[model samples]
Target: MIQVVLLGSGNVATHLYQAFQKTSEVEVIQVFTRNQSLDFPSTIQVHSYNQLIPADVYIISVTDLAIAEVSKSIPFENQLVVHTSGTSALDVLDTKNRRGVFYPLQTFSKVKKVDFSEIPLCLETEFEEDYAIIEKMALSISKVVQSVSSDQRKALHVAAVFSCNFVNHLYQIGSEICEENNIPFSILFPLIKETAAKIETLTPIEAQTGPAIRRDEKTISKHLDFLQDKNQKEIYQLLTQSIQNVKKL
Candidate 1:
């Protein structure tokens, strides 16, 4: 079994620990956390930052800003330490230990149960030998494992923000608009699902539809005028222009 020590008690760490527990090929030796919000199996050990025990791999699933500080706190040197960050570079981990990144390309929530087999695991390590070890651990739970560099991972992270976070915010705006019109936001559920489903087979450019792509200025103007919120109007205009520009290119 691949013995592992987990740091941080956030969504990612908690989900990872849960997944690892279900898999027979990997074992979470200990979890180091300042907050005790998560409930782990009775067999697993939980320690504070300074009381970490020796393990084959130390997975730091902390925030990007805390990664360096957390890595420096580890009492051991030359041990394999990896962080679960998409934006931070691999070098952010203290050089006193072998550094790597084990970024899962999905937004995690404590309440949501993640299917490890579907989630893409992005792995990078300083030493080639370490890659094999990390890969083995990642593959134990996830089927999609790829070697992604720090720069490439950062780009992927930005794209994810655009596709996931930003798109979700747009949904919130749409819901607000629906609410103002006394329309049930649930009425748009099918449309939202179809929009997402289309991208599965069609390129986003090919899946593009509606007034913005068609350059229906009258309809676009109507939407802008209908939106009483200045911010919503601005966003509509900006997105319409952006769509038109992309078509031109």
Candidate 2:
């Protein structure tokens, strides 16, 4: 059995805490947090840094900013140390001679339900033996574990910002446009879903259907007049022109 001490009781930490408890092969030996929590069963007490006990692994599921400082606080005897951060590296865990990165790519929120099996874990470490331990720990929770190097993981993270974070911001803009037009955002739900569905089977260039790609000047003129904000008009114009220049346009 793999005994573990979980540091930080945030969203990711909470998910790992509950899920790991459910697995027969893993046991949560202790939970460490600065504040008291009623969510955990009373039998399983919360702990401070000094109260942390011996375990096979110490998983720090804290925020990116607090990781290095928290690493310094932990008094483990150079046991396996891993952090659940995407951008942060193995070097953040300064305490141990052995360190690794256990980054779950999927976003975590307390009320949101997530399937652990579908979550892709990016694992990395300086020491090869420590890498194996973190890899097993990741596989215990997820089937989609990838042993990615630090550089590749960083590149994937940059791409994720454009896909996930930037796309979410665009969704917010679309919702705002609907609000200004006195139309419910739900009307665009089907279109939004269809756009995502198309990309699975077809290349983005093939699935590209827009006034810009069609070079329908009449529709483009109408859209430009309808756009009240200069910023929105410019973005729409730029994207449309890019589509028009493509050979497939």
Candidate 3:
């Protein structure tokens, strides 16, 4: 079994710490947290950096801004250290010679239980031995483990932000529009789900349906008139133009 130390207690840390503990292949020896909001299993020891104990490997799960400094604070030189971040490069852990990245490409929330089986693991390393060890650990938690270079990982992060984060913002706007028209927002739930479900079998362009796709100026004008908020109206016009561009491609 691999003996590991976990750093941070935020969304990514909470989810990964719990998931790694479930498997017999890894033993999480220590969990570090700045705030004591969470409770670790009795088998594990929790600490702040001053109280931190050395382990075979230190898994840094803190925010992007803190990963570098936190890794520097830990007093381990020979021990391998890996940080979990989608956008941050492997060099962020450069405070230690034995450094790598074990980024899980999935959004994590503290209250939500993430399914590690489906989450893709993006691993990168500066050392050969460290790379092999992380590949094994990542494969233990997920079936999809790819040795993505920093450049490839950067591109994936950008794509993910546009695909997931931006789309969620669009959902927020849709909810607001529904509220303004005195329509129950829940009424859009089915359509939202169906839009996602269809993408599994159909390309987004194939699934596209709207006045914009058909380039019906009359319907597009009607939608523009229906939107009351300036922001919503701008968004609708921009998205419609984007859809039209996609169709032309």
lDDT by residue for model 3 over 190-230, one digit each (tens)? 99999999999999888888788888899889989988889
* Ten contiguous residues with the weakest lDDT in model 3: 37-46
Model 2, span 99-180: residue lDDT tens: 8788888777888878887789998877888787777777888889999877788888888897788777778888989999
Instruction: Please give the TM-score that candidate 1 achieves against the real structure.
Output: 0.96
RMSD of each: 1.4, 2.4, 1.8
Q: After superposition, how far is residue 78 of candidate 3 from its true place, in Å?
A: 2.3
Clashing pairs in 3: none
TM-score of each: 0.96, 0.87, 0.93
| Candidate 1 pairs with clashing backbones | none
lDDT of predicted model 1: 0.90
Task: Supply the global lDDT for candidate 3.
Answer: 0.83
User: Residue 189 CA error for candidate 1 (Å)?
Assistant: 1.4
Off-target runs (Cα >4 Å) in candidate 3 are: 42-45
Candidate 2 weakest lDDT stretch, 10 residues? 37-46
Better of 1 and 3 by TM-score: 1
Worst 10 residues of 1 by lDDT: 36-45
